[model samples]
Target: MSLDFAKLPKAVASRLAKLGIRQPFDLVLHLPLRYEDETHLYTIADAPMGVPVMVEGTVEHADITFRPRRQLVARISDGSSELFVRLLHFYPNQQQQLAEGKRVRLLGEIRRGFFGEEMVHPKVRSVGSETPLAEALTPIYPTVNGLAQPPLRKLVNQALNHCVLDDTLPEVLRHDLGLMPFDAAVRLLHQPTPDTAQRALSERTHAAWLRLKFDELLAQQLSMRLAYRRRREQTAPSLRATGLLAQQLLASLPFGLTGAQTKVLAEIRHDLASTHPMQRLLQGDVGAGKTIVAALAALDAIEAGHQAALMAPTEILAEQHYKKLSQWLAPLGIEVVWLAGSLKPAAKAAAIARVESGEAWLAVGTHALFQESVSFARLGLAIVDEQHRFGVHQRLALRGKGGSPHQLMMSATPIPRTLAMSFYADLDVSVIDELPPGRTPIKTRLVNDARREEMVEQVRKVCSEGRQVYWVCPLIEESEALELQTAIDTHVALSESLPEYRVGLVHGRLKPAEKAEVMAAFARNEVQVLVATTVIEVGVDVPNATLMVIEHAERMGLAQLHQLRGRVGRGALESSCILLYSAPLGEVAKQRLKVIFETTDGFLIAREDLRIRGPGEFLGARQSGVPMLRFADLERDTVLLEQARDVAGTLLDHHPAVVEAHLDRWLSGREELLKA
Candidate 1:
């Protein structure tokens, strides 16, 4: 049952809800982060160093002083041994509580200081004449600001007492798998006995942790499998793949398809001819030629007497697809309508009308296609480019435009295998692993910013060879916080330093017309250098551009850096990308640089990215309104994931009541996320 929010104080209720505790049972299930061994006490001198311990003593002295900095200092003695306690930050009441001759208990890490053993800002509690030590290891939970441990601990204790602790799974299954019941796992996690090993709890190799991880994974897998089953029940148009127009487009292409592309195209054709809607993810490295495959798939929808819409994340990429597809489709007399937010009112209206009245068989634009004003005559296919940029709702909204149109979502960022299996389990995925012929591999180099002058000379050398260069800056404008080089400033500096060649600039803040003009000049080699932000990260393909210099490469992510590097090496000529990084680089940034410099394989880079940064960055907009796993690590708990995936099917097939109970205990209020 849902907790009565009105009965709680406004702030308390808000904080509890933020922690996903809308019901009393939620508090019962909210496990501890770590346990403090408050069950035993230590003398000040005998307390272990570098680990937390509980100690009781009488205050000998207390004062606020500033030798180097202002702080509160106190000396406490347990009759035989005395230790110093310092608080860098403290309240007046806390100073009073540490007054001389008062008995107190402290819990914190102890370390050897200049004078003696010391604890910095330890948890302090004034003792009456006598108080009993804690009976069990104290649990320290995950909490937000303004919520203290005392009240939260009280609520959780009450929940443990009053909330029902029934097992969601049957006794037979629990015994067969050797898994602990859900209630026992939650309880043990919250209140472990003092004898419990800290190493087992900290490392989460305990049986209780395993059970929780298995249950979490099982719930997630069940939700995805059920969603998959329900989706198949919905009806969608079965567009027959006659391969008439697809063959025509393939013949007109200047280059033939790679083996990977041919294989993926066949998969798309099979899905398109299905009665249910196709929710497929087509991903490849930046230069893997996904646009051409999607273009041919659009032709299949058209050949089946239905229209198609291609949507992108940015106007630059959208316009690039529009121009390229229009160029290819124009020979066959296919009308392609261009619609974007930047279009003039009359132009936008005309484009929408043509699409609505079936005058155009293809429509390409940014997110404007998801707008209410844009209606399709018969949107058999809705191909979204940069699927990571659009949220789950936006993609669903676009697909719902023409009564569940078949979707082919495309991404330049490849998804790691484990991530695709767990996070993207609901969707069908197609991968293009091969780069087309004549595409040369880019040599990547990591350079320190101290060598900026050498890079300037390097840029001039590439330009002198009659090839273009791209200078990428992390920021578009000046900011007091980061103080990194901005695109605007870099554009001016490059133009002045290399006066023999023209340098053009483009950024998100620029008008569409102005940005297009600069890109056009750079594409034609009229402008020898293009200075821009990540807006040029994708779809600005200048085969003549042989060099790319990225400033503050440490500030960008692995996917963004890889995409930026892909702009070059599109031509037969050898290309190189130099990543200029600032010193004092963070550990994560260093790992990203090392991975990118070591390997040109996108899949390997994606795997490394997943390891360095968990699944959040890679999941992208698809994480919206989704119930993410809290206990299971996709990489570390592969055994649990495999077992859960297997059990989810069996439970749904034979144990419907158990399935409902498991989902209720785990998902509860967020069941709709599964359907999404």
Candidate 2:
């Protein structure tokens, strides 16, 4: 049976299309998550006087009474027991028909009153001899406005009754799992005895989840496999590493590079010498010398008679990169250009022309690099920092502008290996697990808001020592409606508390130039304390900042806390992070604070975050970009996910061609894009 797609509201139809719910089978498979039994009939013995229950009875006596307001009082009796039911009504005359000798079913909590026992304001419904006396179960479906339970339930039942199921699972799966046919399983799931229902529900849901997981993993593996294949197909560009400029730039550096940095540089050098284009992820914690490694790669590219580009997610970061890269590369006579949206048209045009003509050997900018007007001459390498903020399409857009540039994505978050495999299996991973020698560990402490006075004194002492401090507020601005403290309000409070020192503020709502000005003031030590939101969570390095204060710290995620802590400990001075949260924290919030206090390891924090919030919420609802599963819990469904992954892998390994056939159809449309 085909669904008349035209009957659905246009908006709903458009949404359905977006979600790939185009066919009747697609809608049917979205099964109910849980159920409630509203038709469970009971007698007085089954449900005692004071126990809540659902009962069918006939009305024996009904009357209207006025207790300052009109109300309906009735006496009802089933064949076994008698009870009183009350209906609070302003217009008692409207319920005149609900008098003696009326049959009805009632649902409510039974409670004792001045009389014997009664059900107050129970949900009542009319019933006749034709009504079923016993309903085994009633399904409660996931729903939205305009699509209520009855219609949705009816449509689903119709679909299940008529739609034919395709059992794409190979014989091996059926034999190994002892599974029933797909159609039979669907029937059992919709209608089964209580005992068999549990087993049927598990089997049907597990099969579907496994099937979907297999599709996802296979797509991932295929993408990675294709990337590897493409790299092998391309011949190595004849590029030689001339160490004169690289050595010169290194010697001119104010500080020596760490062993980890040197090792990463060598890895990049090796990739440059290989026949395949490098697709690598550079993972490091904050204050780790990733930028130095990236700069060395640029040096190698420049020495090889090609240009490189470093794309930051924001103009502030881009400008910071340009300044630092220029200081090191400019001295070696390597031309570097900075491009950002904030630049004047004339300056931007001149910079673009310089990059187009290869007059600039290295360019650093935000997404402005991919504008049609901007072109790179002999671009050989592209480095994207904070890769998560940019999607694959954006990265590909930049690569398309160059000649299949060697791509290196850098991230400050240190994810665990298991998560990395699941999230970034398509990319070759390189992790810098060691910190530099001069870097100091940040001492972390958890304190309640009651210690505000002590904390203020501590802040004064830290600032008196000529060290800068970061007082991170929870919100961007003050809102009259919200009860939470805002950065602006905290900034005012802190400024007044420490009137002797200058305080600066930075937040997302501030104009780009204004934010830069405040940050510059803090960096220059003109302001001893900077109060800002998490906008300063990434890539803003100030070595002299020795203290970090996070307000409402319990509300922040572990990863964010780790990032905020990373902002400090840059300098050789002993640094500390003060987590000030209100008292009476919830279980999860308390656990979060405890974890932050117990360990500074980003990977550990990530694992704890996953354990507490589950993978879906940890990644965030918007970030998943995948359909939410009603039957599957990413946390509790790990075993099923692993099974799904294995099944998907086996299918692809045996029949790679199936990926282009029924597998694509099974996946709706994602399979086609995955192949591409």
Candidate 3:
């Protein structure tokens, strides 16, 4: 099962193929994201503090020593100055060769340690008798688990040497753009002279990213185009509103519908009356009253003698949506069936039967709604809550269940129009920008970790007032390696801190029933505070929960922090979100926290999130159907994306039948190459 190294170039032979590197083209496409120059080698005296430096010195002293508490320290130094390098090797006997008086070269950042200044566990190398100090720019390749730096660098070098770039773009385009030849660009990209490296990266690296971005945009356009085509081809079943059931449902509503809701309902009504399947997105921020809009749409379907189904990503969300819809539609005698995986088998089967027999006009559940045995009698409208949580394939799978049910996807994450068009190109979008009247804005504040004790006291005060609180920890458990707080530890600490207040815990690892029970207890005021992970990000609304405290808030993405903040501020009482972060936050984390503190505008926050973390993390690569582009940063490559989108649109417009006529020749070739 040995890999063939001969297929790759000398520069990348060892590392490329082993890392699943296939063709020369593939190596060329896999460009280096970062580079480190070794030319700036320095001595201990010349070394700058807190900066990565290459130090060339003969080892005057080297020894593996242990401290009283069993701390292993490896001391390495030159003739003039000795430096003690600490190693977490409990068993010092294993590394016996690193003994005293061994000459070695080390590369790492210098830092002030507990004892003094040190380079802890630096990358050590044995110095040869007459070896000159090596000086060059080292290319750093993206690596996966089980793969390290040296082998990857060598493999990429080999791949670049052997690869021949078959120029795909027209010569005229290349010349006009002043682009270098593809082969030369690839070579310069891997082992360029300092000047050529920058040019090569600007041309080759960015060009490769542009190519990939173009491919992604094309795939998205094609998928959306195909979806549009297929929908157009289908003979949709028209559902006419009789007005009787709809009127009864509207009459049962406690408050009048917002103007925006009324307008959106009209649009939905028009879609239902048409013979085309409605594929739309219902985007609104938290507490924007999107559920009422969904309920109204369901009523329209139910009155037409058809059924509607709502799918939530989590059981808690499913139950929440079901409760809301049931209360709204109950007066009209509309039957709402709750279907979730946690349901007892017999009960689930009974619910399935109810939907299948048309006894239930509305169904709400998680992914279980698409189960083989759970077919609706006449599924007319399909609503998906938190659409971003589900993948494109899953959404399509749900639609496949009932003659391509009219789709309405909802997201609390308010995406900008441009991003929405790019991300959800296949579906028409409808935004609910306005929140319902009387909805109170959640005041957000940024506090350093030093204020944690005071924050806990504040939470105690809030709990004493009979209001609920949410304390979210970043991670599930404490890592022996990573210095991050865990939800379980925080739960224990909080419980101990406030002995009188009952604290409930929920996380992804908990059983469905356990999670639901905890959530229910929190909702019913049985638990005055909830200590959980991001599992409570989407659903589990406790309106009376007036306080949200996020620990290590800087570690969370803007969109995620916004979602967690959304969990509170749902009730009539004034609410506040305390973003507590560990001090010395990095630049990006600082920017994210600053933006959160600046405004509560979800749309603005989403845009800032996109700029800070890129589109991949914003919509999440797995869910958005948009792969991460190495060269083409969405923020920096806006012009290129727009160009690519325009090119694809023009090509499709002028040659509408080209993809269909030559699917294997055009699209499939690129698709197969991309897969390779």
Best by lDDT: 1
Can you list the residue pairs that collide in candidate 1? none
In candidate 2, which residue ranges exceed 4 Å CA deviation?
A: 7-20, 38-40, 48-54, 59-76, 82-126, 133-136, 161-164, 177-192, 197-245, 254-259, 262-277, 620-635, 642-647, 661-666, 671-676
Clashes of each: 0, 0, 10
Give the top-scoring candidate (TM-score): 1
Which 10-residue window of candidate 1 scores lowest in summed lDDT? 617-626
Instruction: State the C-alpha lDDT per candidate.
Output: 0.88, 0.74, 0.74
TM-score of 2: 0.85
Off by over 4 Å in 1: 1-3, 621-624
Q: Over the full model, what C-alpha lDDT does candidate 3 score relative to the true structure?
A: 0.74
* TM-score sort, best first: 1, 2, 3
lDDT of 2 by residue, 484-543 (tens): 688988898999999999989998888878888998888899999999899888888899
Q: Tell me each candidate's RMSD, in Å, in order.
A: 1.8, 4.2, 6.8
TM-score of each: 0.97, 0.85, 0.75
Q: lDDT, candidate 2, residue 631?
A: 48
| lDDT of candidate 3 over 35-56, digit per residue (tens) | 6656555767778878667775
Ranking by lDDT: 1, 2, 3
